[model samples]
Target: MKATNKTEAQRIAYFGMKKMEKEGGYAFTEGTVSNWFNVVKEQDGTTYGVLLLEKRGVCNCPFWEENSEFGACKHIYWIREELAKEADFQSLTETDPRWLHGGGI
Candidate 1:
């Protein structure tokens, strides 16, 4: 299924999170670059790169390549949530363009 809007992408991300929890999929930042992350699928050792841009995220994963114009993929969603927990991002509101669109990264 293709995600056609932010809401649909969020729904997709929700299911992706459930699968990740079940399969031990995980993601971590690369070096000191807060905007760069490597998402790994533990079950297969597969890795995809996710780059947070000023207004959107780009992931090398096929799903993201196909659906990114509409909204974020699971890796993007996960990283955004992780970043939100960091001190640097704590002051931003959910609706802030920098927060919602990955601008301040």
Candidate 2:
């Protein structure tokens, strides 16, 4: 909940994306998300504050386009941040699973 900086927030966002992918809850058109994050620029006057407007709906905010709605919504912000963070951590993981269901299910 205390993602006080871009690094922390990015980490969470990555995790959320990963989870969504694994759960089959979302789909993407080949590198769209990658392109979103790839295009980052620092500008004046913003708060979600990092000018991640390019990655808008990357967060699951129900009120994003409603005039900076989710930007001020801490819960929504945190959810995305947490997901990002977790995904970042997961990328460093090694491929070693015993397959609890006897196959990679």
TM-score of 1: 0.63
| Cα lDDT tens digits for candidate 1, 1-105 | 577787887789768856665666576657457678887776678888888888788888777877877657777777766676575567878888889866565
Cα lDDT tens digits, model 2, 1-105, are 545555555455556445544554232222344423221112432223222444454433432333242243332444445456556555543553523333234
Residue 13, candidate 2: Cα error in Å is 0.1
Per-candidate TM equals: 0.63, 0.30
lDDT of each: 0.74, 0.39
Identify the candidate with maximal TM-score.
Answer: 1
Give me the runs in candidate 2 sitting further than 4 Å from their true place.
Answer: 27-105
